[model samples]
Target: MNYQPSQNDIVNEYIENLSAEIAPLFLEIRACILEAGPEFNESIKWKNCLVYGTTKNHIQTVVGKGKISLIFHDGVAIEDAYGLLEGDGKKARTVRITSPDFNRAALQDYVRQILQRS
Candidate 1:
């Protein structure tokens, strides 16, 4: 991933308002995603979700009460060798993160796969 893009202001504001419990986890996840796929552009979608993509939306970050869910829009196509992705939707799958110790390697693999397809 070579086309690195800057973070969006609206997305930054959203991160700023996150609760203490979830903010750190969210930031860790965001950093991992950006590092894995630097070509992705960050943006807010559907009012609350922080979406990352190059030409189209790929991953959507949804902050929940005690966890952060990464929704891969083209998830059905990603090879889940780590068995981290969850969901049975037609296209999307999710990786729910509840702690700071979430598997960074698996997450980066997923991001790289998405980058390749995109």
Candidate 2:
């Protein structure tokens, strides 16, 4: 993809550029992140979505052609009681959302946990 992002780039532009199937779910995932806390800051970086906590970025969303990937920065340390997070990376884990009906509570819990740790 020839994505040349600028300083004025926004999350809306990223979402708008995605396919119809992925855009709505992407927005829902972003909504879940925002619901976690009022202190969570949002920014568009590397043509992806990022939600930052008070200290560091809690999660980064990669909107693909079919699915939206929520990559948790410190996912290896998190306790996934519900077993929703995927990937087996040393430090990060990914939660791929193909539908709009993802686990918002889990996402919020993750954000809160990460923020507390930070």
Candidate 3:
């Protein structure tokens, strides 16, 4: 199997150039996502920060413009647990991720679920 840089170069560049106003949150979010695994991937997709799983996990988390989000590429797998998920698609759900209003246990559970699905 092959592996890729977790943050690609863009995510690193973004983090490097983020304004002080949002840099801390970006750092926090980056730290949170790093919980995935040393082998997990980090990259840019659709201009968003993407953390790709090393295995068969169905998630791709991104910190976008005004808010951060976790993309449940397999929505049905976690919809019942993350009641806040919105969208009517067979394969995706958007999850808002603001640390101040975030649920750590639930987020951990979500990450755990993604890990288990593989």
Q: Judging by TM-score against the true structure, name the best candidate.
A: 1
lDDT of 1 by residue, 1-118 (tens): 2122345777667777777777778888888999999888888898699999899999999888999999999999999999989999899999999999999999999999988998
Query: RMSD, each candidate, Å?
Result: 4.0, 5.1, 5.4
Sort by lDDT, top down from the best: 1, 2, 3
Q: By TM-score, rank the candidates, best first.
A: 1, 2, 3
TM-score attained by model 3: 0.70
Model 2: lDDT to the true structure? 0.72
**Pairs that collide, model 1:** none
Runs in model 2 deviating more than 4 A are 1-9, 47-53
In candidate 3, which residue pairs clash?
Answer: 6-42, 7-42
Error of 3 at 42 (Å): 1.0
The C-alpha lDDT values of all candidates are 0.87, 0.72, 0.61
Off by over 4 Å in 1: 1-6
State the lDDT of candidate 2 residue by residue for 1-118, as single tens digits. Answer: 2332323457547655777666567667766776786577667765466555456777887767788788888888888977988887798888888878788888888877777777
